[model samples]
Target: MNPIAANKAELIAIADAVAREKSIDRMIVIEAMEEAIQRAARARYGAENDIRAKIDPRGGDLRLWRVLEVVEEPEDYFKQISLVDAKERESDVKLGDFIVDPLPPIEFGRIAAQAAKQVIVTKVRDAERERQYDEYKDRQGEIITGLVKRVEFGHIVVDLGRAEGVIRRDQQIPREVLRVGDRVRSLITLVRRENRGPQIFCSRAHPDFMKKLFAQEVPEIYDGVIEIKACARDPGSRAKIGVLSHDSSIDPVGACVGMRGSRVQAVVQELAGEKIDIIPWSPETATFVVNALQPAQVSKVVIDEEDTRIEVVVPDDQLSLAIGRRGQNVRLAGQLTGHQIDIMTEAAESEKRQKEFVERSELFEKELELDETLAQLLVAEGFTSLEEVAYVEADELASIEGLDEDVAAELQSRAVEALERRESGYRDARRALGVEDALSEIPGLTEEMLVRLGSKGIKTLDDLADLSTDELIGKGDKRREIPAGLLASFGISQDDGNAIIMAARQHWFADEVTDEATEA
Candidate 1:
């Protein structure tokens, strides 16, 4: 009971009980006890005294001693002894050798016993936490069931049997309520071991949660016949999952849906009746995108592989279905397919095509001295701009069926003249607008873009740098909303837009330092 009175067997018994209760190794507990007793011995002797305790592994007998190194001259009196003094204690003792002086046992006082207990308890708890962390760290992304322990600041703390998991407010299923003692299933999103303990972060709204649920409901998925490729969820509203079958005979969708939707129904119920679309994954993005937008008949799919964009032309009746309510369906389809999708009705697409045709025809007519009939031919040949006719090889232009080499050459020369004149006029206008030529040097911005920015009172690099990428791209709203992105008409990419903005922002650092120096 009392420390120092407790013998070897009693110390070993205490270690065994502590290790069993904490789920740590008995040897770890024994080491902790030895360290605690060593600290107590140091306290009883002197603070500067180098004392140590070693517990016998077989019998757990405690041995206390003062450890001092043999040195030529005693620098510190507590931990070092002169070689002469050490040689007197042991005839064969050499310099730098540690001399262990056995100390007589002393009773551990109230304070000393409490210090030892704290040390043992702290060590055992650390060992337990370490074990828990190791046990659940590898279980990340796996679905685990737990009871809701409590809710604090919208965070749900779930009580796993051994280690607790936390589901932050954003990770919970939307509109799904939880109460203490309510059992819930969640996918482990992340796991971290900190000084406090292992923090197992879980999520019910994660797309992986739905994937795991389907894995549980469908046998083929677990057996590796069906593989869930990608998943997108709107929490309690809707979800889309792309599945592929390694075994051709097994229809991945049919296997996941089960008989009369039995398997999918089970998963849907678990997700609070969220609607799910099981899409057959395809390597061809167009086919996969068409599959992703299910229940909506696609009349035609035009895929822009370079942009990873899919244009789905649905019938007039299917447009609403293809786009979904508030664009959620199409958005989720894009996410699942990993492509940007543009949904248009057949009628709307035809109208857009006609509009583009007229625009291209007019461009050729004015720029290449082509009449309606001649411009119509160029438009039919898919020559969208005069610049293309001017820049492309003569053979490419001549290859357009009826246009001979002489005619093609003449048209190209006219196009070059027209574009040069147009560019000269744009340069004059830019100067008139007081827009910097430096801004026009940016990769994505054109003369027209400079004029637009200048008209908006952005004339300098400083002014341009003050604006966001969205504003430069025309996506950001000013007094009026520009629904389309910046330089959208000029076909600027988001990456190019970001690069242009960054170019504009290069002067920002210089300007900042100048202003700071001025203020100082």
Candidate 2:
């Protein structure tokens, strides 16, 4: 140790002060100062050049280690020393032996101080980045509350306590708005560690958010009394949640609805007025489907278990309600229940049946000496509708063991003729009943215009039946030209118009008009 070397106690104090000021660790500062001192010492003392120094901050003691090398001559100032100097530094020093010498100094030049400061800063920054990486990498998929710092390009940049998260525009719920400085709580969707920084991803539109919200709001769900089986949503529009209960005593729907709809309302408000329909889930496919189609009573639900399809039947009045406005209600129901739905009305079914009858009318008229069993089979196959049998495929009929293609074709042709005859009869009946087509042809009859005509006691085909074309033309009503032109266009004989009118009067007058006449 040399007196001019430096004060070790004073050097440790200076390094400690520098570490505290720069927010760098004291050990970092000590290491950096020691390296700087060793560089200066090698420049001064060319003897054993390998020299290093480190300071103990608490004890204020200096450690000295020498680097002794075996060589004929030194190559670098800091690395090698002459063999004579190496042996002088270490008595046992031999060829290729290494030594360490610690050098401590209190005084530092401007450049040295700057170099020391840079080293300490670099070490601390690297260590801090490693710490942050370790801390946040394990926090993925957790929930966190953060403040909205700014909105850029429709993305919400949230300032979480230790990191920032980006919520993209598409992830945001539709029709919802956010403001700066608002406290938003979201689930941490991802945590990515990169060399630059840790990227935290959070989401407000995750399905788990809805599930957790329900669990928080409904005690039945949280306490295991009621369980949420499945959920489907068109966010900010409507959501269908299927719920079941483990305990029969618990009503899942009632629990979700709360008294007067408070429980569901809380969730609705949080979702920005989105509608929530909590349906009771059932294991039976038919019963579950019936329940999913809420507010519309299902008369029947026929399930094809093999195909996983459901056909729903509703009454005539309920059909429109079941299908909903633009089919949105049933569509959501299908999504919730995972089934394909087809809706039908009783009136439509009956009309289909009547049309079938008209088509098949000639088949019954045919003197078919067919076996009773064949007739029964045809009837069972929906052939009662003459149209259905008229259009029956020959190959299909031949596929039946007892039927040949020629018989099928004959049956089809006869059934088709019968259907045509039935339609003609129906048309005649319409004319005889003073149907609007007949009246409209009689002229100047817009439904509204004819309604006015009816108001003036010029009602029905028969009332107009008694009057001639010339009589109508000369009557000089304001609508004369139209009436004359329309009457001529109808191209009907007086007898035909009169007969139709008489039939209509008899049919319509008996029940409705006769009673009204009596009352009058």
Using Cα atoms with residue i matched to residue i, what is each candidate's TM-score against the true structure? 0.85, 0.53
Backbone clashes for every candidate come to 3, 15
- Residue-level lDDT tens digits of model 2 in 155-204: 99998865678888876778889899998877777778777667777777
Cα displacement (Å) at residue 440, model 1: 7.6
Worst 10 residues of 2 by lDDT: 472-481
List runs of model 1 lying over 4 Å from the truth: 1-5, 430-520
lDDT of residue 13 for candidate 2: 71
RMSD to true structure for each model, in Å: 5.0, 25.3
For candidate 1, the per-residue lDDT at 36 reads 90
TM-score of candidate 1 versus the correct structure, residues matched by position: 0.85
